[model samples]
Target chain A: MSTRELKHAGLNLQQTDPKTHEEAESRVFGFWVFLMSDAVLFALLFATYGVMLSGTAGGPGTQNVYEMKSAFIETLLLLSSSFTFGMASLAMKYEGKASRISVWLAVTLILGLGFLGMEMHDFVKMIGEGATPERSGFLSSFFALVSTHGLHVLGGSIWIVVMLVQLSVFGVTPAVKTRILRLGLFWHFLDIIWVGIFTIVYLQGLTP
Target chain B: MNQEDRAEYRRELRSYIIGLIAALVLTAASFATVHWRLFSAPTGILIAIYLLALVQIIAHFRYFLHIDLRKSARDDLQLILFSTMIVLLMVGGTLIVLFNLKSRMF
Candidate 1:
């Protein structure tokens, strides 16, 4: 490599040639822009949730519907998945074996699915208990904020699946590597958003 | 891979591990604080949880996202900071205006 761009870019973008490095760096930078915009989107949703916090309309609110056990478990699952994705990224960078990277990716996928399953369970139970989104502005905004994050995770999980296919078919090409880098950013970004959810939405919701 | 390559790989792996552990601690602390009602005042608990979340978010950005103040990553950092500014403005403005209007109405 002409420069330590790979190392500098966090070891995930391991392009060798100068031209390839420059190109990948620019694309990754562009992906950063996309993520920041997504952050803005989520922030506004959070704002909406905050403003609607008291519009429960005499219906069930956070204390009535939220299960701390499940929320904490979901948080752990997502956090672990982020770590696994980081492992997968490292394997992609260093390990010559496609199998190794695929293994870590599969683990990350399972953790992500586990998270989605728990969240789906939570939503199902909430609705079953008459805590539907239509119940109040509060519940509406709650579902809106939380489900949007869930959808992002769902999308990221599908991206992981697609990447697995590409790894098998294309075998770690620069293009595939670039895609992986962006996906890593997306995955970790979701976890960051989860921090906000668990803190602002769940924890804050639990407060008196 | 050379010896140096192996060393670098190990170092990278260590960073992820560190991030994971730190995150787990912060997550547990936030949950515990709420679950146990560690603070008598609701406001105190809220501030504690938010502070924990802030620190954990920064850790994730540094260790997992590999965002630092390094010159190479400076552009990405600027993008994130600028985004934060916009988010603050929009979210902040929305809350201020709406809450003020709510107060006036009631």
Candidate 2:
């Protein structure tokens, strides 16, 4: 690969030859592959959920533990945050405004934290009501599926913070810019998974 | 990226927001339908509602997530479709097999 190719691959997209786009393209391509791999992990968890769905041992089934109103509110927050994050990415990459991107990122981060806060409260309430993960196999799967998502959101929240700090220090450097792009993908991808969780794990659990 | 493109992008964002709200409402209605027994229906109707909500979820992905097949990386959609098929088989097949086995063997 020429210096031009290496540059687009996160070396210097702003100044390099446009034909050297494979590096930037490859970064996204690699991320898509990673997303598919993640789908496999989710598939496994989903299967596990299906298999153990009836193993509730008559102890507070999904309907008993799941709170639709709270979940609805949580869904609203995350979905809106995903939208805002998309706007931040647009501002950063397309609009090329450092401060505008930062503002959007801040909003996204606060919404994410709010979702996490509410989820934590839900979990505490579940356990307090004796529906802890150890209560049954189904509970175990439920906690696994939902908390895995919660942890991912928490990680994404940290990532956004770091990116903001980098933005202030580096001022939209290509590296930071590329990272924000990937993070946008990551954030939105989590919201997509939450759509599944809210439907299958939360809603179906409430079903007879 | 310019004034017109920015306007177009905002339009898309607004649509995404609208779809997101619809998905949320549909999901909530589905949940409440089952929990409070909001209507007179059997499991079949509930299952249909569930399927409808799932469609809305896919809608969210299409409009909000923007995961079109064209933008997918090489073989990503192929693998997802294949894996989804396998997931369907494993989940559905097991439900049938185990229920049958539970009845006969037990």
Candidate 3:
């Protein structure tokens, strides 16, 4: 199908069932609003982190705690997952084949899981080195920010599994498509936040 | 299904691949700048990294999120811009006040 045909398909759906199309559009817009609010939350955490970056209180600072290699790997995993999820969305849009979509989704899920595993390992290592949140203000903010992002990833991973199940059970219903699209936005949003974390928290901390 | 559709799909896929490549290259540059000590001054390195990060954020937003300046995206674009403004005001103001107070105390 050409782009025109795709557009026509959408228009036809809207013409036939205006209610569903309107609902989907509003649902997407609502999700965007939610994402913006989430962004504000992250921004607040980042600001708190910036304030406490040096408040080690005689404890381990970021330089002493962060491992650049693992952080880099985590970055790669998350970025690749974002791309894979994009592929999943494309498959859904173009091929409209549930199997193809599931394959890409599975790849994304694995990458996401890998990222979370690496992050958890990093946290364990930090804790092993006595870099717990209670050690200092800096550690407190660090854990809060990083763990919040990690929790989002965990939630997203769970969402992916749920989506896979839904895809298998319901096929490509309008509701499922809307849900998947929102999930894609959520996944990409996390990656964007990770860019900030790596740049501000890890890279900057490791610089000097 | 048809030739024209296949061509459209290819074009879309190509754009996504381009985006992925750009993001990866930017990420590599970020790591290399620090690992190789490309910039001697810490401040300079920080600035470069921040700039690189800004670009990468835009890349992800444009490619993966499909956020553009097109008419259809206007509402989302406005929402994002407004949220950013609020966040900057709140976070930036808090940091400035708190940091200034800390400096004054010591």
lDDT of the candidates, in the order given:
0.90, 0.74, 0.87
Off by over 4 Å in 1: A1-16
In TM-score terms, candidate 3 sits at 0.95
Q: Which candidate is the best by DockQ?
A: 1
Tell me the tens digit of each residue's lDDT in model 3 across A1-208. Answer: 2244331111112223667866776878898899999999999999999999889999998789998999999999999998898888878777777899899999999999999999999999899999998999999999999999999999999999999999999998778887888898899999999999999999999998
Structure candidate 1, residue pairs in collision: none
Off by over 4 Å in 2: A1-16, B1-15, B18-22, B35-39, B69-76, B89-105
What docking class should model 3 receive? Answer: medium
What docking tier does model 1 reach? Answer: medium
Tens-digit lDDT track of model 2 for A152-171: 99999999999999989899
Compute DockQ for each candidate against the true complex: 0.79, 0.33, 0.62
Looking at model 1, what is the TM-score of chain A?
Answer: 0.95
Worst 10 residues of 3 chain A by lDDT: A7-16
Question: If the candidates were sorted by their TM-score against the true structure, best first, what order would they fall in?
Answer: 1, 3, 2
lDDT of 1 by residue, A114-182 (tens): 999999999999999999999999999999999999999999999999999999999978888889889
Model 1 chain A worst lDDT run, 10 consecutive residues:
A2-11
Summarize candidate 2's per-residue lDDT along B5-102 as a digit string, tens digits.
56655765666677666766776666667667765665754675667667766666566555445533325456556766776776677667867776
Pairs of residues clashing in candidate 2 = none
In model 1, the Cα lDDT at residue B41 comes to 96
